[model samples]
Target: MDDLYDFQESFSYKLVKSETTSVIPSSVRKFQINFNFSFELDVSEWILSEDDESQLVSQSHHPVVDCLVSMSSAQFSSFEESQKYMEEKLTTTSSGLSRLKSSNRRELVDYALREAGKYTAGGGAHRVLNLHFDVLLEHEYIYLRDISNYDESTRHMVPAEDSSIDHALKTVEYSLDIPEMNCSVCLESLSGDDYYREELLSMPCAHIFHGDCIKKWLRTSHYCPLCRFEIPID
Candidate 1:
């Protein structure tokens, strides 16, 4: 199971605001950085049998970790000092970074610190930066078969056509029309600032997902997540 799973990680940063507060003395640079993480898992299994049509297939997705971590910058002059500071700050946090490999964690922290440093070069006494990280691990189990005797039934999922995807893109909508709900992909709440800030895509079956999440999903399959409603492929 461990060898069959693939792990992926990504990091993004946004400078929320940089202001010189009169309350805080200009001599002090109070740099604050917040970290938000969304962790997910995708599991797939296939059991082949003598009867191709009788093969058992199962797939599921759910959030594994979702949490926020924040750290306030201390006075650091050199690059090495900054790196050490970030590593210490993140190590004490309760974020998903603790679960990642030491090397992976270092890479993520290094990248984030570098990005944050870019804007803090000439910032006011108070500068706030928000960083979002996504960690995904996909696990799959399938019987090993001889390529000479390959079968089409082995391929379960089909990719949608480009035209069909375009139509779906045009159907992007918001969740404000409906009551509070969760996006099936990321498992995050809808009808809030997150969904409102970004458009949500609605399938023909009336199921809605985060625009970015559904866009990534549509790249691999045309079926609606919940109802499996097929968007016609031209």
Candidate 2:
């Protein structure tokens, strides 16, 4: 399994009700909920088997610690105002949280942006956390693919053609006119003094090799051994 994405965010305040009052008191219950939190979110990508239809992926994280803050309600004009203020903080990055380093921090930032772009994305109840929390928030977001898919990008996944490959080999063979030069594969000089002169071949990348060495390599792969340039197997 590969950790492909990390998603984490924190909300600053909670809405609590008093049992003594039939109706919860309005006004932001602002007892100075001034606390900053640092956290990590990691999601892994896995394909259980080649035969499997749906991928089994897991995202995991530790629960946020209870480092509560107390604020005076007088500081808030209204409950709605406090809620709005906390929501605004969601858009801004805190200096403390951004200073830390993580391998997946970039993926975390990308995930957050994609979620914000969605009209349906929000924090609510969902599954797959593997543990229960007092408040559970589920966010549905898409991972924007950054790389081209292998199926669409290259038709060379199949076998190479005999005529095309033979042409490439002949071009390279004709260019290397030196009577004595080293074969890159076997590290031996190809000379008029040695046999197997007819067994030499050249890739489209112009690297010279013994026909045997390259043919064996090309049997499994369709790329130039030296430069990793894709061979047009067509």
Best by lDDT: 1
Q: lDDT by residue for model 1 over 1-234, one digit each (tens)? A: 111122233433333333333353364356666666566657564544435332334577765656565556763346677677667655544333444457756776676667667656876454556666666655455543333344554343455677777676545455355334666666665454643555667776778777888877776656666555776544
| Tens-digit per-residue lDDT, 50-157, candidate 2 | 233323333333233222222233423354454444344432232122222332333333333332223113322221111111222222222223233323333222
* lDDT of every predicted structure (CA atoms): 0.56, 0.38
Model 2 bad stretches (over 4 Å): 1-159, 171-181, 192-198
Worst 10 residues of 2 by lDDT: 126-135
Those runs of model 1 whose alpha carbons end farther than 4 Å from true positions after fitting are 1-41, 45-47, 51-63, 67-154, 169-179, 192-196
TM-score of each: 0.40, 0.28
For each candidate, how many residue pairs have backbone atoms clashing (under 3 Å)?
0, 7
Query: Candidate 1: lDDT over CA atoms?
Result: 0.56
Q: Which residue pairs of candidate 1 clash?
A: none
Between which residue pairs do clashes occur in model 2? 30-71, 31-70, 31-71, 31-72, 32-71, 32-72, 124-138
